[model samples]
Target chain A: MEPERFRELLDAYGGEEQRWPAEHRQAMRALYTGDSGARADVQRARELDLLLDSYRVKAPDLTQRIIDRVAPTGLGRFFAWLQPTVPAQWWRPATAFALPLLLGVALGLSDGSSGASTTVIDWELQEQALLSVTNEEPWYE
Target chain B: MQRDEENELVRRITRGDRAAFAVLVGQHQRALTNYTRRMLTDTDLADDVVQETFLRLWTQAARYDAGTARLTTWLHNIAHNLCIDSFRRSSRISFSDDADSTLESDDAPDSAEHSRERSDAVRQAVASLPERQRSALILCHYQGLSNRDAAEILDVSVDALESLLARARRRLKQLLEEFHGA
Candidate 1:
């Protein structure tokens, strides 16, 4: 490596050979071996590296706090259990089919497809229908 | 953690396994915290960013591609992006007022004091570097990431990352010299 190139790398990567780009390590070592000026530059870079090392980071552990926030709630956990463990490709077609079916079910419920006054029992039936549509196995016998 | 193990944990996590998520957090917490602290210079802010990063991991585990990058690289990428968002939110990066003290065990009081002063100077010098340069240095130097991985985190080419590292070192040396003649 040329002197200027060596200095540029020394400035960027510091004086540590391990930190230097693998492609140039042999050339850099050869240059440092033969050149006093290159050695001096490396020494200067090492000084800066050591100085930089002095600033050690001591951070607090926030593991549980993070975990608490991300843990699934009861409802989310229920849906999570329903999610397929198969490769994601299995779900794409399922989702495409399920979305239109869900929309149709919503429309039918709103339209009062039974042609009679809707009641609490009707709402329960609608909920069950939506749940059954979402999962392969029926929610009711 | 090995990539295969991490992949397995993530696979389990995708299936809503709390145990797997906790395991991932345990593996990366210290390294992520240390990287964030060095990048942001505030312990509280760094912790918040690290938390956000893991939360994203929980939500976005399906999006991660192990073939594209290691879990550490992916985690750092998430943390790095959040750090950038924080910079934008605050309209500027803030430097910590307190410099970190060295953990040397010295018998002589005077030598310890001198060592502390030098360490303080170095910390301030690093904290004062420009954002890109500081990120490049911290990812490659303190985090022990390879140049290619650090480059990916910074969204820069390896050559560009190297340029940033060089400039950071040059500026750091100047800053240290001005701070304490070190």
Candidate 2:
């Protein structure tokens, strides 16, 4: 790839890709064939990739304490523990049944002739969303 | 039935089945923490993010749509959002022009001469990458997520992932090459 195109990639990929522009991908992919000329460039990129891989930190230990504090040992009792600190209404679990029932209905609807037009609701999005919820970072969702 | 399994687990948890939720947490904790660590570059923040992630899961278990996506995807979505949230919460600058030049460090994780040399160079190169690029690369290259998956986790498109990855690689090579030359 030319220096100009390379620079464009830096500018383009430097930001988060969740909202990445479509045109940039088409343009970049066209030249990403690992061609002879691009070989050198890609080699350099790969080297960086390997190095970055080395630096990637190991995942933290997922012991019981971490899990306990996060998920809480018991919802009812835990919320009961928090009764003094938080509102009592917050612990109610109405949505637990309602939401899943609604989703189940959606799943049932997903089986009809309209399946072709229906979005699969890509697993990728769900993972992202749940991760967002789990991590307490609602904004990313 | 992965989605089905996840949804069932969620339902079980909602019914006050702590064991069911523990199973989910057990399944996801490592991946979630690793992804957060890669994104935040801070152990504490990663922990906080991971904790927040599960907390959300505990609460949102009901709202989750089983047919919409896989349990893993839902989990990733939670962690990704928090990473971004923590990133913004702190006033840390996103990139450092001087970050690449400081490739020297005394702490080394590898013992072999060749391993030490290369790993050290790579470590510095990764540390020097502009924060976002470093996060992107760590999750994709090191954490073993696909570019598309990383992009989704980071809330970017595949093209954007390639772009960030492309630049991250370019800068990493440039930095490592400089370290070796020295």
Candidate 3:
């Protein structure tokens, strides 16, 4: 690695050699051992690391709090009930049988509508009246 | 946590298993919270964001494709996105008021006051960084996430992430020098 590339890697990764990319580690180590300027750059990076470590936040143990907030409740429960767990394969056959049955029921209910049946009846009556008139007026005339 | 174990827990969570959700929470809460706290510099907001992160995991568990990334990387992605949202919603970034409380209470018996001052200066410098730079620093430097993982969380290429980290460190060094000089 060039001097500038080594500096960039040190700045980006940190002073620790292990944190540096594995592929470049051998080259970086050789440069570091051979060059005084590279050593200074690593030392500066380590200083920054020390400053960062000093400000480490004590992460609060909020596991239960997070659990409570994320715990499914009220509307969550409703959605939970609606979530399908059965495999799609299981539903495929069931849906196939159910879909045709549902279509038949829907057709039957639509066929039973009073307005449609009434219209059919009116058409049949007109046909019968025409037939009677025609039969009576035929042969003698 | 083992990848297989985490994956199994997530699978159970997808099935609406609360106990499994709790286990997952226990496994990752501290790391997530610390990452947020460092990024946002506000403990309360960090906590709120962390809670929302887990809640999102619960709600969006089915969207998790373990084939692509580890669970920690995925979780950090969610947390990082939420933190960005929080920043946009409120364009204010302030240091935590409680930042020095621990320093004050320390019984280190030497230069406690000096340590507090130095620590405060460092925190201010970190907080002063741009949002992306600060996130890159927090994830890689403090949280110990790999560059690739941090880039994934930040939605940037690894090269872009390294650029951000470099700028952040350069600025931090300058700021710390100025603080000490003052």
Candidate 4:
């Protein structure tokens, strides 16, 4: 690999060999061993990686809170009951799952918090662009 | 969990199977939470964002296309969008608020106080980055996401993602050097 290409890969994937793209790993290893400049770049990337790793997070469990907000009713509730009892794991298709649920059920299940509404509005504003991740529009400036 | 298992769980979740939903949550909550917490630098906001992400998963389970992206990448995309929304809604981005809460792990390379101070410096430096750069770095470096997946989440090309990562690291190096120099 050329010096510039090596530096780009180093910057993008960091100094860790394991994190390097598999296809380029062999070339990168050869360059790292033969080139002092590449080694220096790797050292810088390694230091940054160590610093980045220093920042950690311990998040609280929100599983119950999220589950409680689902609140299935009527047929949905029946299915919820029947789900465990069913033996064969038949699944509906991605298209079939798009059928809209009742508005009343949506309202009924609402946690009545601003979060749901805020998120809905956010999605609504970006719905056209968000449906596809490959959209060119940036999420933020 | 494996991709097949995640797909199955998501399929069950679409049918209102709370058990599968719970299982999915148990699998991803920590990583998702860590992503949001680092993005927002606020525990409560991160929790709310995560709740909203999973809630969307529960409600919009049908929207998920396994062919498009992996389960974890999709979830991170949801949380990242929410974090951006949170950024727009509020101007209060403080690194100090959650800096102390991090780096509580028992194994430290130095004294606890010194480690925390260094950790705080890193957090502040990361927080100071432009939103895109920070997301790029956090998703790829901290979240251990592949560049392709991170680019998809950021809605950028692989080259663009690399650019963001490179800029982020360069800026972080400058910031940290300045911090130590000070």
* Candidate number with greatest DockQ: 1
* Residue A56 error, candidate 2, Å: 4.1
Flag regions of model 1 displaced more than 4 Å.
A72-141, B95-108, B178-182
List-wise, what DockQ does each model earn?
0.24, 0.14, 0.23, 0.21
When 1 and 4 are scored with lDDT, the better candidate is 1
lDDT of 2: 0.60
Screening candidate 4 with a backbone cut-off below 3 angstroms (N, C-alpha, C), the clashing residue pairs are none
TM-score of each: 0.74, 0.57, 0.74, 0.75
TM-score of chain A of 2: 0.33
DockQ ranking from best candidate downward = 1, 3, 4, 2
Q: After superposition, how far is residue B77 of candidate 1 from its true place, in Å?
A: 0.8
The sequence of per-residue lDDT tens digits that candidate 4 reaches over residues A15-133 is 98877767889999999999888889788788777777777777777777767666665455434332321112124332234435455567766756435455335666587666666
Error of 2 at A130 (Å): 77
Please identify model 4 stretches exceeding 4 Å from their true place.
A74-141, B95-98, B107-110, B178-182
Docking class of 3: incorrect
Candidate 1, DockQ score (0 to 1): 0.24
User: lDDT (0-100) at residue B11 of candidate 1?
Assistant: 93
lDDT score at residue B86, model 3, on the 0-100 scale: 75
Global Cα lDDT for candidate 1:
0.80
Ranking of all candidate structures by their TM-score, best first: 4, 3, 1, 2
| Prediction-by-prediction clash tally | 1, 31, 0, 0
Interface alpha-carbon RMSD, every candidate: 6.1, 6.8, 5.7, 6.1
In order, what are the TM-scores of chain A for the candidates? 0.48, 0.33, 0.45, 0.46
Which candidate comes out best when scored by TM-score? Answer: 4
